[model samples]
Target: MNRMAALRQYQKVNSQAQTAVATPHRLVQMLMEAGLDRIAQAKGAIGRKDVAAKGVLIGKTIEIVGGLREGLDMEKQADALARVDNLYVYMMKRLAEANIKTDPRILDEVSGLLTTVKEGWDAIGDQQPA
Candidate 1:
């Protein structure tokens, strides 16, 4: 097989393995990491003038963050959820702005915000609901 195809196969298998073994908390952490990874890659793509990759990576990052926001339970703690939801929306807007203006600084801003959120989530223990 070609190098690209082999790499894709490897990634697919690796993802499947991770999914099979990951707990809910682990999955959340994984998702957070993936989002950060995509944004970092998008920043690199921007630097390299690879417009298509930049767009794809930024879009994927937005989707991941949006999924995280959508999974929030509004009834669990309305005030806190609303705050976090707003932050997610803000992050999405920043992501779009980064894409539109081709600004790596905007990507950095969103990455930092995501890292902060991920750190808080990481601090949560077994009490977090699945």
Candidate 2:
């Protein structure tokens, strides 16, 4: 093959790799992995009904959600992003309440909420621009 043809093929391969790397599915997968780690830490606290540890986990989750929200473009998917943001805020509130009450039930509630959020995110098309 000529030099020009080889260059074109290389470019094509590089572009495809970039596209595969930048999909929304990958973003969701990253978030789910981080969330599972946080949830595992929180689970121990929940079992003991330890308010302080619960608060720490809640703070970490909030940080995760905040980071996600900052990267999200609400204009592109206004309704969906808004709903996700609202859920994140609600989760923060519930976490606070759980900490104050030392309640394990709230941990279960947050787990369910996070699961739903993850599922919803996964269902969306992975059309993020490369």
Question: Mind giving the per-residue lDDT tens digits that candidate 1 earns over 1-130?
Answer: 1223322322432343354455555666666788898899999999899999999989888877776776677788799989998999999999999999999999999999999999988888446666
Off by over 4 Å in 2: 1-24, 49-52, 125-130
Error of 1 at 65 (Å): 0.4
Q: TM-score, each model?
A: 0.82, 0.65
Instruction: List runs of model 1 lying over 4 Å from the truth.
Output: 1-17, 126-130
What local distance difference test score does each model get? 0.78, 0.61
Cα lDDT tens digits, model 2, 58-130, are 6676555555555556677789778877877787787677667766678678878888777766666445444
Residue pairs in clash, model 1: none
Report clashes for each candidate as comma-separated counts.
0, 0
Task: Report residue 26 deviation for candidate 1 (angstroms).
Answer: 1.6
TM-score of candidate 1 to 2 decimals: 0.82
